[model samples]
Target: MEKTFTEEQRNFKELAIEFARRELNPGSRERERRGEFSEAGWQKCAAFGIPGITMPQEYGGLGLDTMTCIATMEGLGYACRDSGLIFSLNSHIWTCESPINKFGSESQKRKYLPGLISGSLKGGHAMTEPDAGSDAFSMRCRAEKKGSHYVLNGSKTFITNAPIADLLLVFAVTDKGKGFAGVSAFIVERGFPGFSTGSALEMMGLKTCPLGEVFLQDCEVPEENRLGQEGAGAAIFNSEMEWERSCLFAAHLGAMEKILESCIAYARERRQFGKAIGKNQSVSHKIADMKVRIELSRLMLHKVAGLKGAGKRAPLESAMAKLFISESYVQIATDALQIHGAYGYSAEYEFERNLRDAIAGKIYSGTSEIQRNIIATFLGL
Candidate 1:
């Protein structure tokens, strides 16, 4: 499919590029060294209308169309080097903000959407447990409906914004025997009784985004806090995932473009033996591969975004985009590192961090293996 941006998209992309450069890139390397999440950078993004791009205007959002959002995100990735912060923002935008906007009752939206979109209330969904990685429906978190409230008991690990989150969208089993149908979703306050967050776990990369555990032991949530209806967690999760897979990796695509551009620039400048490195087939071929991956990744990402912009569900397309872009990102990152030679191996160089961040794309949202399974099942496997 041929993709062309309209005037609005072009404007949004320009705005995003400027915003990321001015607001998000400063102090990024230092923050990354300390593994710190930048609160100021997050608010800067909020002021730029990033966290709320897809939400309605009344809720402090830009209310941009999906492709425009994607385009702006690509711009953000291209200009910003803080991949972890971008990842955190993406998690909040898609997994938390979009679902609440789509499935939330008006009161829920009025209560939560504005704070979240404004970046005053950072949060993310809690679905993955120690045991429920790929088998999400096998969640052991139990919620017992007791009069006007539900009592929750379980622990969720590897949550993206757990330590800093003021709120959390939690999934639990409301009916033990119904399997997936038993699952239910709820919004829990950080201070709610029995709700606690663990220390941020250090990771191989994307350390600027806090990752930790959410523990809910005998936590009571008012019935009013439940998302959608009773036993609707599965549907809500799938709904979130479809949007997440389709759009969340947009920044990574932007990173790939940036990496490709940087490598090309380097190839033209660095002299190997006698001529520029771009002269060698070994060096030039990697750059060529990077170009192909970026082109294909952009096309696929755009296709899924266009589908979503039309209000159609795109699980299969989203899976393909997620699978392709993520794997391609790692490949491009690897190649970028190779092209940078020894410099890529040093912390002083951006390529080292780029490769580290790209490796994570394969694991989150759904692993590459899981994406293939979803694609296979969609193809009548």
Candidate 2:
């Protein structure tokens, strides 16, 4: 199906593609080798108006609609090979900025939105704990009210940008006797007393975007820093995951497209036996299947984007999109690698890193298993 885009949206896509290639593409391999986060590239993107894509224009954001935001993100993934940088940027935009822009009060927005939009402050959400990866509502971190402030305790693990984040949205139980409804969100700053960060914990892929543990030992968060209603933490967390499920995989889509193109080129040029490898039925079928997978993923993603643009609740669509796209991305990457043979397994090629990164996609933002459970409930199955 053909979809129309506004002239402005088209311009946004072009700018994102060009800027990502020219600015975010430099030294990606070397930076990943050193396990470096692209702080400089992050600033460049913020200056380029990425952090504010879905924010209100008054708050120093571009105020782009959901579709435009999706298009720009997909463009960035297409042009930028620094998967870690892309991951960091997406988490910032969708998880942290989007929620604050929607739920933060005028005063709260005034205090944090500008700096976040301006790239002066980095932000990430902390919902998962040591025992609560997929079961977010079961988090053990707690926050207790103490007169003028809330005292936060417990720790969060595998928090993105944790090592260098200036701001964090920590979700903890305020009244555990009430279960899920007792959960609440607090905005904790780096310099806050009793708030500490641990050393970075590395992974197989996305080394450029650092992850670490956050510790809060009676950390006092100001009353004003509480996001939304005290018991609405689960709501906020669910909404953030909904947005992440719908939009976070736009990068994966772009990466899959790139992999498809690379596989085609490799098959066309790499001779097997007497002729180009693409002439073989196996190679051609893989390329065709890759194309099919990309189109399917694109359609599913666009469906979620369109619903979100119309200010619709798309929890079902979001779950389905994330489930299909994340799984398809792994398959597409595998097929691309299979088509490339030894070259795909070699570290010199970007395909290997993409495969590693794609594995994490199935695990994060509601794992594939969790997605299935959500979808099953939606179907009354």
Whole-model lDDT per candidate: 0.90, 0.87
lDDT (Cα) of model 1: 0.90
Looking at model 1, residue 370 earns an lDDT score of: 98
Best by lDDT: 1
Query: Tens-digit lDDT track for model 1 on 183-278?
Result: 989999998999999999999999899999999999989999999998899999998988888777888888888898899999999997899999
Q: How close is candidate 2 to the true structure, as a TM-score?
A: 0.97
Badly placed stretches (over 4 Å) of model 1 are 1-3
C-alpha RMSD of each candidate structure in angstroms = 1.4, 1.4
Question: Candidate 2, residues 144-242: lDDT per residue as tens digits?
Answer: 999999999999999998998999989999998998899998889999999999999989888899899999999999999999999989888888888
